[model samples]
Target: MLPAPSSERWKPLRAGLVDMFYYDQEEFWFHDGRLLLRGNNGTGKSKVLALTLPFLLDGDLAPHRVEPDGDRQKRMEWNLLLGGKHPSPERLGYTWLEFGRRAADGSEEFRTIGCGLKAVAGRGIARHWFFITSQRPGAELRLLPDSRVPLTREKLREEIGSRGFVYDRAADYRRAVDEHLFGLGAHRYEALVNLLIQLRQPQLSKKPDEKLLSRALTEALPPLSPGLVTTVAEAFRGLDEERDALRSLADAQQAATDFLGHYRRYAKVAAKRKAAGPRLTQSRYEQLGRDLAAAEEAFTAAQQQLDEARGELTALEEQRAELEARRDALRADPAMRDAERLEQLRQDAERKEKAARDREDDRDRQASQVRKYDGRAGQAAHQAGTARDKLAEALREAADASADARCAQQHRTALA
Candidate 1:
């Protein structure tokens, strides 16, 4: 059997104060495997951690020296070392770690170092790194090799495409450190861990294992004897025949069901038509008959009114003729020709003629008044007809407005 793979481990070093500068403390160390930090509240326990950023990133130690020159010219230089190896003053490895937060102010207080170191023994080195936080419940170990540098544009492209390979120089150096510390080789443990993490997290990348399902199903069945197989084959043939018969029955049942559904729909439509058709026809015929009868009655009433008007006109004319005849008879009487009596008779006749003329004028004035009243009645009737039309138009507009409001309400509901 193959031996179990070795797991990676990380060990913390010393961490505390080194010196002091203007507003900033010189140095602090928290590397006793127990991340101890000291200072008063707001006195740079966190600043110390920040100052140690270089050390954490490059695993180097540098003195916390202050600028002694007033001109800010030359000052004491801080020399740093990583894993006991002196780090170059120019460049250093980069540290990637999460920070803790200040309990009082809820501020983040952490640091990382950037430094690179070459092994004196001419062999590659692996670095180890981890995170410590007070805000979170527990510590977590970050398992990743130092990022590797690409040799060419094609390699860069490959690394970029793969996404599993480290692309940055600083990340590559850090990952190299981790690989050395964890005894990892060229294999992709980071990618595997990331894949496992993705699987553990709630993501949409999961796929069903159809092959595993098939295997499981096959495994659950018992081994088959030759006779048992033959018998099963025969049984399956018989079952096929039975299945065909059942299929035919099912098809027949389905057909019957479809026919019944169609028949029911047709019957419902037919019944509705049968019930509505005669009623609609009868209603139309009855309405037409009633309209015709009403029109006939209205015509008859109009004719009767016309006849009555004519009769009244004829009676008035007859009364006028009779009055004219009486006046003529009074004028032609023989007593009016006597001499003395003739003058009195003439005066009387003139008075009687004046009275008759006055009566005739009065009758003509009354007839004129009746004609004016009839004209006013016609105008009122026309005005009433116009008012009815206006009322109908207003009703139609109100109905349209109501319909529009209903439609708008329905549209709003649909959107909602």
Candidate 2:
């Protein structure tokens, strides 16, 4: 008897509502020997092909369970099968096919073949079947002449290459096909499939034969010039230095980008302060100068007035002394002892003397105040004037500096 076929399994790649796109369910199958699929247009035919891909690759289709609707007890079912020789004795060797149908109550019913194989092999020791599809009838099925064929990754690569197909990432390519063709209703999928078929056909290798070497020839090669070698090395070194510089520049640029976010806030505050500073300084300086000048003038006038009052007080004091002398003389006289005349003369003299002394004392106090006020006002005026001048000078300096900075900035921008 012929050796048993290799063990295999099928798992669902994708599944969806059959009634959504079409009135009937669509399905596909991939056997170890052939690929079989059937569906009408707009009936999720290509969708089934996409869904079944993982299953055909012998990968887990329903490795984890997912609840359907709110039913936590529901188990995720896969549309896959196992076929060929049994890997273990407890399981059957053939893959059984199944389909899902919608019930009247909006539930699904799974259908399956109880006995007959989904695909059959020819009656021979080297029997095998390869199921593929094509728009053309005869072109769909390809038969292997014998069972001596060995499949390998390199062989598959070569086969795919011959047919003008490339399987870099099978999953990605399948998704691209499904999305571009089936999902989007474009012809790109059909073109891709056809291209894959063309590429899968066998072809001869084009690599050159390495066995034909010339062993008889023996020759000495000339030495390279030291100068030329040094030049080349220097060039390489220069290139390496340039690459390092570029990497450093890139790092700096990234750091600058990060810092700019913080810098922007600081710059805004600084700009506002800078804009207000000059005008404020100028106004303060002008007001301070006016106040200083006014204070100084008032203090000088007070001092002059105090000096005139002092001179007037000195004259009054001299007059008071003369009157007191006269009163003493009158009191000492013999004739002054006469009652009415002596009393009237004494009273008149005392009154004049007291008035003169009082005027003198008031004038003296006023002079002292004038002196104190003059000193204080002069010092205050000097200080205030100095401060005003300094502030004005500072503002001018700042304005000049700002103008210079703007000019420098413009120059720099121009150069850049």
Candidate 3:
């Protein structure tokens, strides 16, 4: 009996979709290990697959949404290269796919994968890259759409390596998708997924013609030999010049169309102005004439006012001259000049009288003080003269007593 598959060898299935096109969200579960969607024309099957076109081609989430979702929050859009329209000039919306392994126990193990396109501003394009979630429970499979961790080339390589989706930038994310999903070393898995989309399309998956089916089969498989790829690549090399020429022609055509449109718009405006020029100039001339008439009226009134002002000024000058003559006559009057001199003489006499009164008062005060000092001096002299006479009489009496004492001493000596 064949050994039952172990969990390590479990196949990864593309289980569900969320926020895809107008469906907004749709979930599916495995039925006999397969889920098929069917509808008539104009349903969303093509639109849903278009969302996966970027990833099937090269693991891009597409640069935008494949179809409009009424539930989408952002309004911005990009003219995407791969497919879809989405917001963000850089870092467009994330595309996520969850891979799960179903078991008989009715339990499914899931590993969620999501990525975003990074805008290359200089190139005016974007490229696909993996996202490490910014929210904690760090960069695991399941994360909110908006949650993101800053990641770049080497950082992403290490992350994918750790996630068992090892890759290099040369082979890029295709290898990672193959490794993580199909356990393949090459990117045939991506090409196969693209084939699956076409299989669902009524246009490509119609009633099979035998030879055409054979051709499709050949295209489905990768070339068995490296030399086949080399030959194909060498043949494609010759087409590069033609492609570049076509691109250049397209660019030239676009530029010429833009220039012609701008020139036409400018010419229309110029023609309108030319048509209006004569009327505008005539209206301006009429306005200037009105202004000129008003100015001339004002000039005539000013001239009359100036003449009246000159007459008033002349009268004022005559009045000033008469006042000057009156002033000169007053200056020459002898009576007026004498009255001025008499007033000066009266002021000088009053000043002299005031000086005489002040001097007489000062002399009277000094004389009174001198009399008081002289009376005190005379009384002191009289007392001193009387004291001297008393002293002189007392001295004469002392002299006589001394002479009597000396004579008595001599009489006593003769008696002895």
The candidate maximizing TM-score is 3
lDDT of 3: 0.47
The alpha-carbon lDDT assigned to residue 414 of candidate 1 equals 34
TM-score of each: 0.22, 0.28, 0.35
RMSD of each: 26.2, 22.4, 46.9
lDDT values for all models = 0.42, 0.41, 0.47
- Say which prediction, candidate 1 or candidate 2, comes out ahead on TM-score: 2
Candidate 1 residue-wise lDDT at 166: 36
- Which ten residues in a row are the worst by lDDT in model 1? 134-143
Candidate 2 weakest lDDT stretch, 10 residues: 128-137
* Model 1 C-alpha lDDT per residue in residues 102-135, reported as the tens digit of each score: 3344533332222222122232233222222211
lDDT of 1: 0.42
TM-score of 1: 0.22
Error of 3 at 391 (Å): 99
lDDT by residue for model 3 (1-416), tens = 11233345443245333333343234444464455668986775555455544344355332332322212332212323223443323433334455556666776555544554344333433454553221112245332234343345455545445433422242465654555456655646755754453344343456666676666555656655888878878778868878998999999999999999999999888656653543343344445445555545554554455455455545545655665575466557575468766576446435644544454454444444444434444444444444445444433443344343344344335325
Report residue 79 deviation for candidate 2 (angstroms).
97
Runs off by more than 4 Å, candidate 3: 1-32, 53-91, 102-108, 118-127, 131-170, 187-201, 226-416
Query: lDDT by residue for model 2 over 200-279, one digit each (tens)?
Result: 22221133333311110111122457998999999999999999999999999999998998899888877666646544
> Which of candidates 1 and 3 reaches a greater lDDT?
3
